[model samples]
Target: MNKSQLVFVPCPGMGHLIPTIEFAKLLINHDHRFSVTVLIINSPFDATYNAYVHSLVSSPSPSFPTRLHLTLLPSTLPTNISQHHKGTFLDAFFENHKPHFREAVSNLESGPDSPPLAGFVVDMFCSPVFDVADEFGVPAFAFFPSGAAYLGFLSQFYTLMERRGVDTTAFNFKDSGMEFAFPSFLNAIPAKVFPLLVLEKGWESFSRNHARLHKKARGIIVNTFEELESHAVLSFSSNGGIPVYPVGPILSIEGPSNPAQQGFDVIKWLDDQPPSSVLFLCFGSLGYFDQVESGFLDRTAEVGIVIGWAPQAQILAHGAIGGFVSHCGWNTILESIYFGVPVATWPLTSEQQINAFHLVRELKIGVEISLDYRTGFSNGSKTEVLGAERIEKGMRDVMAAKENEIRRKVKDLSEKSRRALAEDGSSYINLGRFIDDIMNMK
Candidate 1:
């Protein structure tokens, strides 16, 4: 069989880029007929983004020996563009790159020796590029780095508006007391806990545009296992005309982007502690941050390490990790599940509150710290400090669980997650199906 090329366009964020690369590796390693080239959007703001890419480009992992190629799209957006306003930045970046991206793909395909361009697999954030895919008469699949549940939750707002005939231009999310029984979530999620993007005023149009772009895509590729979010996965089949592929728990099991973040000191420290003793408080790349109070240093001398970037997977895998006080990012949630550490959820932004809701309420794999905290506000305003009691309670609930069942469930799921990557596993089978779908094209 002839080899095929798939272009992966992941936004410059570390969380999204890392998993996309891993998925690329999985595809090429599992089936020799596919080769991937990840096209990176220029993000000068994130200092670590390029550093991480450089690490992967320099040294590939052994376990999954992917000849995954990297190409950085030039900085086409003008320097005069305001980085402060996210909406302006997103629109500018998305629109500016269409012609540049088209030209780049044209160059890749110009050589007669190049493999047939099978499809464009893009990050959820880059949905606008489906237009580019259409230009080439190639299918584009939006790769949502988050889980199915979050995607389902996002679509619910739009679905509700469509069903109710609510005008997107006129509608305002002023009803704080509102609640909806989103299909993915087992219980009705409150308006207060909805992602700020869906609720905030100026963002309504952006959200609408994003959903519109998504409709143009051939399908969606979610980063979750069928065994984990079976309900949300099944829901997509009945609802949208588009297909949904849940092939994941896709992780970089090897190491981080920076070689300096290697786990020597942190591992040594973890080795010193007893089994199930440490409560980890690391967040994802942006540091949707949390910190211990100075007064409590004497009281709790230990959640103590202040390293720049610890080996998160290694730390989660350690015997000393009792539980995680997490920001509830999708990747973080999966890692916690894979490592069998129950989460004490402290959601900061994006779909994190929703994730925290699903984990604590729907899935029952974790407990909540502050589900609605700091999730509803952006633009560097609204920084409500959590009371010491809430922090203490969260730490207490995860480590010393009132519901021992949460711990037991997480432990069981960890084994299942590992198996999902194996040949006979659900994700493995879905991954094969994903490849077949690409080959069939559509």
Candidate 2:
């Protein structure tokens, strides 16, 4: 039997690429009959990502049964696209790159000695390329690198726009305390914490197109486990025309080593702290702390350790790190959860605010810092500085002796997360089922 090969196309960002790669490793680890070829769309802003992808391909994981392959596809977005109309640039960028992506897939399919192309697994941002998968008669799956709740919300929002002709962007400007109910959440979601995409120009139409493509996918795979977002996963699976698989918390156990870790005195300092005593603050690559608010670090240095950058996975897994003050990027959240670290949520942009809300309110594994922090496309005002009081309060809440319930819940969830990747576990079984579905496609 010819080995089945799956093609993964991840969006240009490190967050997207890392999980897609980890998912590929998961697939190859669970079943020896498969191999993966990752097609990375190189980003001009992050040139180092290309080298990182190359390294992963060249140095296959020692644990996985098969090695994953990689191909770097040139980004088609113009350099000037970011200078103007930045809100819709991602939608525009992916649209422009579709033809090139299509050509690349075509060439791969026609090559001699190529494994049978089982299917295409594309990042959520690369939904437009489902057409490319169609051209070659292979199934395409949408890999959402976020939570199932966000997926459920998107599906629900799309339906509202179609049926009621509602303008979701208008919700952003509504009364400050207004909340809207979605099928996925038990409580109403505040407009402030809703996805930033709804407020972007041309977002309604872009989202409509995305929603249509989502339904057209062979299946939608989310990076969450059934235990974590049971209701949201069920809601998404029941309503979407396509099958939705909660097959994740798929994370790299050993992340790429941060070269900046060498001279950073923070790691040495962390070694001196008592176990579970320090709060670690990490905003992702695109996120940053305001200069004015940087003084909060000086004030709280004794209680916390702030680093500009560190090996996040390793840091989260550290014994001295008790709490995470995060931007609530899905990857960062998962890593924190996997390491049994509770969070103090400080959402910055994108779906992060929603993720933060879920972590603090829904799951009760994290404490809230400020849901009102203004950032992202919708906020054109001056950069909102996080007050020291709010920061200090969040730190206290996460580290409080009375908050052991939060700690206990996160620790239990961390074990579940580990088990979900084990043999016959939820994520393990779902991944196997996903692989079988692909193999049957051939």
Candidate 3:
């Protein structure tokens, strides 16, 4: 009857934290001999995340609340740490949580209901915590919530730079024409589409540290399915580095859409739209639109309701939604694929550029808004405004054909994704194998 409890340290960003929770829920739901405790690294920049965790802890008909525990780490940002900090400040932000995690693990060991500590599943950004995991004398995993391709970039970029003697210092973002033979992609990857932060002035060291940690973990768990990224998924096996577990399309909580609940009006609005007509353009919660200068009151809102936040999965699932104007976040990419909605790929940051490339060039399931249009906190790309023409073209191309090649592929993958998560499917079997790895850790 002994159960091994796994502690997951997910990064504070909603894009990262939400999926980690879903993965934790899956573990406890799929098997009875395992339990999960998700250590929340709260973000001072966003209270929405705070509300999210509260909802998980306080859900009325909880999914796996008995065996799943979500609690805040004691390292909530202090007065000295400014709310508007970035760059190395984030490094300090994650580093400061180490002792808090150590203390939380200590407290868990003493708790009456606590199971034997299995190990730690550290998010890609929370690599500093691998040190604490090392101290605890248990294995640690690097949870890459994005996908196999992004994981491939992090796993190999250090070698790409060092072994080739490529200079990180002199790298220029202006060389949009250059391409690299990155291992993950089917086609040669354009240099311009690589993550902006990794090439920035101060982030090289940070990127290297992350690359180093990816090697240190016993394995990397990706929120992807083998059917979706077979090339990138298979690349890990040949390299003979850290093992990878593609136990995903590990999606967010999906309950029946209710008219009375949050995001009801948006859903109700969509109820009137014709099938394969509406295009959902959501940039995730971290993104924003002030919408001040334009004459707001006179607009009919052709592109569905413009809300602060959305039940994205529900909207995408609706027959009304045909194409998604996406930031190409991995979660949204999988969701778009799951719902059979094609994407107008517009990458904002992180490895989204590579994701956009994957969608447009490799899978042909998306059209590009601006493949190399990198942006940051202040929208620091060469052209920030993204002209109306380019945006229109992206939307038009994706929505151009109802039963086109992109649509067909998306539908096929959607069906395959559903099966992959079902009993005895690829992702399902992968999840079992990952769990077996944990149980064997004992």
Candidate 4:
């Protein structure tokens, strides 16, 4: 009676690693028959990342049924790879790590006393591992850490580009607002809200390779609940080639609270604020507050609590947090929604632009700072610097009583998000279905 083993390969970033780890915990908790081995690609720049992954295993919780094991592979790229490609290092890094990844999987499979190999679960960035999974006669699942709408857009964009023969990189949106039809959306997606990958250089080849690899996967998993993105989830699930499962808002109920911050000064500051009176602004890992113009900071400080960094999940869950000024990363969007905090959408890079659109337009849970704002991707496009006035106005709009309806809507959705992860909810059922599908794989 050996337990089944599922190998997970997550891209070398906190954003990808967090959700993938949570998903693994979900699988093991849902049923005791599965164990997860996460293969993490060593980060040359961040020496602490591997240590963080190891901590998850070392610090086991009594609540979870099983512990996750982690293995750190050697750095696949030279130390100076970032100096070469600059912003496009992720695209090149994943492509270069194929050999290292394949060898690691082979070694794991050949080890004596190994549990029966159930399948391979890979981050969307590591889709190249599909071939390795096929070699071992196991199913490979693509885990998308973002919303279903972004996944739907990725799946449909390449086909649309081919059909229209439009070079997205060459298209200019100086004065006119260009719109394109997507099956996932009832209305057309404006050029301003298109993913930054389409606008960035050197991403065309990477995106094409990603799309091809995704199509080869046996199934796709997204970090969104069906109630949140019904249309987009249906679009991905109906593809017929690869089955798609919506099994998320897969956040840790315990939350990622920093132990050191228990009695910290920031906690005192938050305690002093009135309930639902503060606004929390957090971008993802690479995000920085210093990149913002000085004038914008001066004005925002007058309106809200401006801290360098806080425990985001804890802050969002706080009674003092009324609104969020976010870069609209999918994780942040989900967290804010979970806490019933409306957002002032200011998308920075990657699929955030599309997520911003969904937050503001579709979900009606967020207000927009600017749809045309682009930064952090190094796409040769001039970075849009928002002035103090615009920033203040956006903040005012999000926190004002006029936005009470939006707040009420998000509060309702937050309850639904929680229920979706409960025993008989949509996400819970989908996760069980996915696990059963893996067990049935022959």
Candidate 3: stretches off by over 4 Å:
58-61, 76-85, 169-171, 174-176, 253-264, 292-304, 378-383
Ranking by TM-score: 3, 1, 2, 4
Model 2 residue pairs with clashes: none
Q: How many pairs of residues in model 4 come into backbone collision?
A: 0
Query: Of the candidates shown, which would achieve the greatest lDDT relative to the real structure?
Result: 3
Residues 14-72 of candidate 2 have per-residue lDDT tens digits of 89998998898778877777788888776756666766766666675676444577777
State which candidate, 2 or 4, has the greater lDDT: 2
lDDT of 4 by residue, 346-417 (tens): 777778888888888877788888665767455334545788888898889899883488888998889999
RMSD of each: 2.9, 2.9, 2.7, 3.1
Worst 10 residues of 4 by lDDT: 376-385
lDDT of 1 by residue, 1-442 (tens): 8888899998878888889988898889899988888887756567678766666565655654545777777767646765435655666677778887898899889978788899999887776688899898899988989989888877667888678664434444423466778787678887667776766565665666666545777778889998899888888887756788888899876557455755547889989998898889976777743575677676666556656676789889999999999888999999999999999988887778888888988899998888877534344455578999999999998998433999999998999999998998999998888888888984
Of 2 and 3, the candidate ahead on lDDT is 3
Candidate No. with top TM-score: 3
**TM-score, candidate number 1:** 0.91
Question: Once superposed on the true structure, which residue ranges of model 4 sit more than 4 Å away at CA?
Answer: 44-51, 54-65, 78-92, 171-176, 253-263, 291-305, 379-382
Between prediction 3 and prediction 4, the one with superior TM-score is 3
The number of clashing residue pairs in model 2 is 0
CA deviation > 4 Å runs, candidate 1: 58-66, 78-80, 162-175, 257-264, 288-303, 375-378, 401-403
Candidate 4 RMSD to the real structure: 3.1
lDDT against true structure, model 3: 0.80
Q: Which 10 consecutive residues of model 1 have the lowest summed lDDT?
A: 167-176
